[model samples]
Target chain A: MQASNAMAALALAVGASLALAAGSAGAAPPALDEQLDGAAPVISVPWNVDAAGTAAQAETLLAPTAWAEWSNVLGIDLRPGGSGMEFTSNPDYGTFWCSNGSSPAYAYARMHLPHGSTIRFFRMWGQDLSASGDVMAKLRETCLPNVGPAATPTVTDLATLQSSGSSGSFTVTSSPDHVVDNHQCAYVAYVQFPSCDATTSLRKLRVQYER
Target chain B: MTRTPFIAAVFACAFLSSASDAADFPNRDFRVITGVDGKPARSDDSYSYASGNYRCTNASTRATPHVVRYPFNLPEGTSVRYVSVYGRRTSDATPITLRLRQVCQSQSASDPTSTVLATRTPAGNADGYFISAMEFSPSPNTLDCRAWVEASFDISTTACDASKAWIQRVLLETEPSDRIFRGTFSVNVDYTLP
Candidate 1:
């Protein structure tokens, strides 16, 4: 019995030591290359509601293009740029500032890069609305005014482009004509709305990406 | 020096050692989750689907062209070869595609640098619903691939075939996505290699 007890004790001691050694050796597991690499860049297109009965109608019209899950939401954060982003923490329908009849709303999205990937820009094309007339779309960086006042962002800075139209209602679309920066490890995309109201709205945004 | 005592001791020791190792193993369940919500008023455009064709629903709370992230863990051996993805659209029947493989070779543990393995589309269908399959091996060296369905459903499909999107938010499959759901959900699929 003593021999058995002694052997058991020795085994326990060895096992415990092995476990401890392993626990200590492993610092932290590195992050994985899951979806970011292949996943498309995040694109935020603030819906422009300018048509007659547009705000309510656009929702039903673009139901299919709507986000389906929590994961589909754009991930956006304030970057380290000279000018920062501005949004309401508890916005009823996004941060509202510009007027289309009611408060204009915007959407934010976020994505992660491989820490050192360079993003080459491409030409941007968008329509005023999904079921549109003349193409009307633009892109921009952060929505401004710090929830107070904004510079009425345009495609020049944020790449916001106003689609040409014979009618008044239009959808804006745009992307970087220049290079896009991959800050640290995060990449943010913002869709701003200066007058994405009842007369004009934004829809369908795509970013052509390259390695 | 008795043979019986020695044999019994050896057997007993072997059993106890194995039991300890098994206990140390990741025998418990774990989960994987990922997603996004940047622009609110943009309308919900993104969607999610799981194995056995389980779809995620978007309440009228959030909007679209969003970001999504899911976290899932795996045991020593897990395969990541194939997964499926589904999307919806409205009057615009364009597809929002998702790829299944990574672009770069990476370390065995976690690979966040490898690019997505699938292509993006403006449309979604069963033809669009496949994931690549590889040898089932998740170890300490070779990185298992991760996938992403770049965009979400279309406005046309969501309105007309909204039922399809509704019956299941849509489809997004990974061969061993089981790596994530195995421990947590009631998933009992075989991962043993044939």
Candidate 2:
């Protein structure tokens, strides 16, 4: 009876050690501190007037055609010139300004974030290019869950920048409902004229978000 | 008895390694399906059926004259890495310029309303039915092929989540002049998932 008891005790000890090892191995990585509000992430694309010197240069900086390249080029150029464009920390805000020429310009800024991030707020400062026409800004999101030939993505409009006249600045905050499941998001700002001759200039633009 | 624990450890290690090696992002390929004639099939599982001859009257002026669209879906954590297109041209001398677009469910259902992603003109070969391939970088700043004319937007994001997303669609228009031709084309996409 003593021998049998010894064998049972040995078995139990081995089983317990194995269970402990398994538990240690399965432990998850340390969680990020949720209490601290880190610096907001920022992605900026400053406008390069030099790059747009020629049609081909504009196409290279923008796209193939005039109509297709305008908005995309403007989108990349909205950043403040110099070292501010560097993406070192998560920036809570961004600035977009354009003052030169105006011929019904539209711009978009796109960024990719870790999935499940939330956009907390947006701040805008702008001077209307035209006294009669209004400028509009929109926040758009697209999510691609699986990357393959069979994969489809969902697109949603998170928010819209309130229309501003020739001069004004505004700040808007997003609700918790603004959280996104996908990784890709963008901000589109456009200025339309009543006539083909109208033009608009954007002096300031910013966005804030949390991962 | 000790050998049993060692075996279990080995098994656990193997499982963990394999799980890490498995594809985080899905890769997909589409191919052409030919008929009995051995030529490019007009309508099959591989290609979408379009009425009438695929013609480009003023290829240079025509705005997305002949567009062939293939629908796809990307779940949540995945983003595009590279997109490649392969096809044949009727004349090796006549280069074919094609534009690739991404149609998101939230954006637009129609092909014309979709966003233009990239454009490429594959170099032609002497052989009439020679296969040509072109690749596009996932970034809007770079072009994988010299023939690429434009890089409008990048698809490196997890936001493409929908049941009916148009992953790839080609807009065929005449770049040099008017032309009418029948050819076969397909797309292969590489992606990364979290």
Candidate 3:
């Protein structure tokens, strides 16, 4: 009964929010009224968040120690398409630093953390989900593994981004362009349950914006 | 025996009523699951059919700023009454300040020479090192609507800087008020058009 009620309440909240968003459609910014008369803004962008074999090999998966900090950073609803964007549209280039997990803990950034401790593919930008961005990517194993002891998962920043160039910069004055970040957690069957931890993590991703 | 039809009628009525209750707009935002594959020639990918109020947040190392031009298809003459900016930090981090600006695009952000529609500096917002405006000018054809945030953290104060930015996903609950901007942990609003 509680679960059903919770689900119903959640449904209502989403409905309300969407209704709020589902207004007259294409409500142009007041400042643009004087500029754009009647034309659709172009929307096009590319993404890049591929992690090349650098995940940590672990036996169990527990929330990262820095989960609070990570969650705080990702939980706050920034902007719709994305928040605090670090890329320059004109230059279409930028970089960010991602270091290893401060501790052996992890978090599901408002988004889903991959299953089996894997950080799988995650969307870096989207009007669809900027609201829930901190959830770890590809983590379906919600219940922490039960073993003699649980090992905290760790994350390490493998590289420094020089530029985040979009694949195809189709100017989008209305929509959003996003990049995905990949984090991988290794699972050790031989080690036993509650031993899952992050194996490889890609800290920063870069995308280009262009014609 | 003869009451079977009556029961069926009642059941149908109940179902319809329940559906109506669920069909409301603010009731539940439509969440269309989307995915991207190789290309047109490719077979394309398979995203599960999802029914959620919102989409998942994009993961990034830095707190990225994303601005989406809204209402992709509003009939011509769709004059906007107001515009607002809503934000919230996904993490447990407290006080993730957000700054909303309404500056002229043609005007220079570098030179600070453009005319601002409604600067949040005087309002509940601040004029950070990096602040852009949401394109709401009279011209609908102009590709101008935009928003930005200073995302880096202050080494000394340990606060989020609006000047620095990232390319992560951002969610919008509503819009922002003309006089009010910058949310603590999270924010939502309807917007100011006048």
**TM-score of each candidate structure, all chains considered together:** 0.29, 0.29, 0.23
Instruction: Give the per-residue lDDT of model 1 (tens digit) for B65-142.
Output: 232222121232233422333333322333333333222222121112333434545333543333322221232222
Candidate 1: C-alpha RMSD to true structure equals: 18.3
Q: What is the DockQ of each candidate?
A: 0.03, 0.02, 0.03
Predictions in order: lDDT = 0.31, 0.30, 0.23
Q: Rank the candidates by lDDT, best first.
A: 1, 2, 3
Model 2 lDDT tens row, B1-194 = 98999999999999998789856422332332121111110111112222211222221222222222222212111123334443434331223544544421100111011344565655444432323233333322110001111211111221111111111222222111111111110011111210
Q: List the per-model TM-score of the A chain.
A: 0.30, 0.41, 0.18
Q: Could you give candidate 3's per-residue lDDT for residues B42-77 as a string of tens digits?
A: 001111112211111222223333322121111122
For model 2, the DockQ equals 0.02
Q: Could you tell me the TM-score of candidate 1?
A: 0.29
How far residue B85's Cα lies from its native spot in candidate 3, in Å, is 8.5
- Tell me how far the alpha carbon of residue A196 in candidate 2 is from the true structure, in angstroms, after superposition: 5.9
Q: Name model 3 segments beyond 4 Å from true.
A: A1-211, B1-23, B26-94, B107-142, B149-155, B159-169, B172-194
lDDT by residue for model 1 (A1-211), tens: 9999999999999887655433321222233212122233443223333434142111111111111111111111212111122332111111122232222344443432222222332122122332232322233333333344556632234454454443444333222433334331223444444443333322223333322
lDDT of 3: 0.23
